[model samples]
Target: MKKFNIFLMLIFIFTTVFTACEDKIIDTTEDKIQTSIKVTHINIPYVYNVTNESDITIEGKGFEQTDSITFIPRGGQGGGTIKLGIKTIEDEKVALENSPYFRDGEYEIRIQRGILDQLLGRTFVNRIFNASIPDREGMTVKGTVHSNGQGVANVIVSDGIEFAVTDQNGVYYLPSAKKHGFVFITVPANYEVSVINTIPQFFKRLAGLASATEIKDFELFPVNNENHVVAFMTDMHLANRNNDLTQFQSFIEDVKNVYEEYKGQNKKFYGITLGDQTWDQYWYSNNFKLENYVDQIKSLEFPIYNVIGNHDYNPYVSANDWLGAAEYRKVLGPTYYSINIGRVHYIILDNMQWLNDGGSQGVVGERNYRDFLDQEQLTWLAKDLSYITDKSTPIVIATHVPLFTNPDQNGNFNNAMENTSELLAAVSEFTNVKVATGHTHINYRNSPAGSNVYEQNIAAVSATWWWTGATSAANHISRDGSPGGYAIWEMTGRNQQWYYKSIGFDKDYQFRSYDLNNIHITSATYTPSATDEFKGKVAGYAGEFATANKNNQVLINVWGYQDNWKVTVKENGNTLPVTRVRKKDPLHIISYEMQRLNANAEPTSSFVTVNSAHLFLATASNATSTLEITVEDEFGNKYTETMVRPKAFTYSMR
Candidate 1:
């Protein structure tokens, strides 16, 4: 009986301890769930008058009594940190008030629970001029949309929620609440909104308490034509220095000249800089002033759009890390917006995310990184796409980072969109989609296997980060041997064609070649072999000549090589197929190595060309008299260049 009692007690104690442990685990999990807050909806007006304090209700999940809310101004003047007073808090609802001195722009709201934080929502606050009190009925906001002083009908105007269409006389009227903030337009197709002092003049601000109706007018530039030509330039990295501005102005002149050259082709010219308009570090030091750059860009005859790059972030003002883009919003209107020109819908996205850590130079207060589109942006994109009822309309997505890219030499992805697969899935329903990006400073085009979308990664305007002018080339040449340039894309209804235009070079200058004298080539393809000495050489001869042994080889780097493109070499009038090679441009390698060897050499390159996927190789006997290289791009543009067989040059191998 005594033994039985002891065993039963032991079992009971064991059971008690196990139950307590399980309870503890359950408690920890419940706490985690409570801290994982998510915002579902916000009952804030799209626009709030700056003169009045507005009440906003935030509805979300995972709210605790200890939680607090904050409002951070996004862009424009009168922006700083303003904590909202939470009048009430519930499990699903939190009511807060905006500051009386709120700014005239978009504001970001955030929720803080202990050490955990999350973005609650965003609202736009504006200052309206000559406003009045509302009668029993709301006031009316009227606007007229015109193109080059001529009325344009069927234009959609809105106040971020209610929309109105312009009449035959190009006039639109919308009922506005007494506390309305801004009256904006939807920007009709084949037309561009006017920009004043770098601010897109698509909206009219309403301010003060009044009793009269508001009147605003908007002008859009027409771009309707058979051939619509748009320029894609990226990574200007304009510093505050005069030299950088000079280079950028020169590039702008080149763009103007290109427009002039094609003026007689019945093409309408428009240009957009993909991103990195200004290096954040320099701009921040200059007190975030952009008047000069804005003036320069505005001087362009054609309408030019801007994209938000990682380097264009504003980090000094806001305490919230994600609010670094506030300056960009102030300087440039909304960071992400869409416009339609003819049959193509151009969606500009802000994918650069600020890390809050110090930048590369460690001078800028904050570090900005790429490849993230927040939830708010995703929601906006879905809504924007829903308005496009015509599924056949081609879509052009322009961003700073590439949505899809080939892996680096180590078989790893670099500087690509983090949510690429998700983004692609969202746009998968669209048949014709082209993504244009700039940041890699190399020109590349590829179509993912099953996506059927062509992604073009353009070279930087400030080629090699403004390092090319000191090299022997003395031009804006990227590390990939692609000259710093922009791309010209022509859209005709649903069909599109594009080509990279080097700033100073003619359109025909697409590729460069090197002749290798008789070196034993055993590989059937020009692809870099593990045993090939030339593939690893980086400090040998410069320019288009390479020593060969028993195998006479010809190497080529087609800067704009696409899958549909083909390269063929005719040796002594005999046509021979050229094999694609994974090798770096010999010119880039030599230039970089020479600069490295001589410390006194100017910093003429930012990246070394390690391996190029667009390279090609062809081999022939030493007796071959001449070599004629022919390249045909995807659009059936053929370019041929002939070179005389040169005697083998000797140089010490690296």
Candidate 2:
């Protein structure tokens, strides 16, 4: 039940637009200066869509006092208010002249008040352009993208397969076959398109035959973001279950605080979500779907360019991959697109092909998808890269799954994305290419030996599926012990830097040190009051720390560790040997594992504490010896921890 409030005086800003009485244009105006326009279905509460342009019939009251009608385009397109005089006038109904029809897009209609000062319906119309497309030679779609009294040049435009760029006059034409039935732009640097409900309107749907021609245009506002800060958010997995809403609110607040802190630094802020905004399993059961996901983050001040994860497909549309992604494409623009922020050329891809094996009209499927780029995406990537002449431009390929998998205990890497070779070869020319991804629910950076591409497989915002901190409000740690948070990327011209920001903690909180002396998770102490089903379910040392040896050892979990990062430990003012080791995070074991065990429930294996390669081990001289730990990333930023011997480890320890 969301409403778009429209006032008659809005013409000075948005509009007192269009005479068409369509959609639920609820009159929420405060002044009551004039009545609003509404097209109420006589038999039922229904609003008609803009189906035809020739026969524009508006049936509503207060039409006698209506002077003119206007149509305000959504998402801040270049064209101003499209006002039209009423052809027929009456107290109950009226119709505009059979001309000046709206193109294929969303628009808000408003009533121009007459001298009598009567109220009218301020309606919102989704104009459906089903006209006969004209045939053209050499170009199928053509238009000019202009803004602020002039045309902007060198902007990239595409229809998924074919790519083109605007000329010096800001005019471009695509010789497209209309394969995807939509055209979009790669919103160039220093400019941005407007948005509706947090979704960027960088694309427009097409009409008619493949051989037909259609003209589509996009206008944007110029911005100064050469030195910008983008919030790399990912893996929301919002399903209205396990208190996810509460946790998501906390995430929003955390982002807002971060933005406010950096608001006055002469830098613009933007957000990019790595995907999994909603769970398809709960779309029908909880009555919360893609639209609900948009409403959740509507309070944010900036527009969020999104990526599509495997869980964001239509579960019951297994008839085909295209059908499965229909809802996502309809709700959140295109599945795969690109945009420019500063010197960074970002390409957002949809690698998860929804092969929902056993789905149907009303039945759920296996909900399984793969981590591979399809042929079409690869082709589009090639077409997009062809337009960029500067090979040194920092390219960021954002997908849901990592292109390269994280290394294991023996420093061995496995192929996660099936199309890694193709993807690598595609971007091999770029000198500073990087990939940002999620879905592992753990933080890890993958840098192949001599490859130009680097990957940061970030963790989830809803850490551990919002389970660890549901009731206790403690330790919202990921599988690798990274706290529930997002990545902060600072871009200055061609140079880029990033760091993992733990929510509820400062930016300097990079690593956590655990004193083995005070760390032990035993069923006797944690699940002592549990029932028989889960009495001895918990284990000490979490499988790795199962032994009873009282070795004076310290384990440090550096969630943001990479190959070039350095770790050092000093005990009693003397340097101690530090070795990289794979082990489970103890705090995660107590915060998530023991919590479920104490509740007499078998903990999910996926959510359980697992061995992480980012861990380091150091042996101390004595149990009472104080140790100082320092970690330095490749960017030369250092974080330190001073361990006052037998440092207490608790579920809520920071």
For model 1, how does the per-residue alpha-carbon lDDT over 159-237 read when each residue is reduced to its tens digit?
Answer: 5445667788677777766243556666666667655543456665553234555555566776665458889989887
What candidate 2 gets wrong by more than 4 Å, as runs, is 1-135, 208-212
TM-score of each: 0.68, 0.83
lDDT of 2 at 181: 62
Top of the candidates by lDDT: 2
lDDT of each: 0.67, 0.78
Pick the TM-score winner: 2
Number of colliding residue pairs in each model: 16, 17
Kindly list the per-residue Cα lDDT of model 2 for residues 433-507, writing each as its tens digit.
989999888998887878898899999998898898794636688988899999999999988888999988999
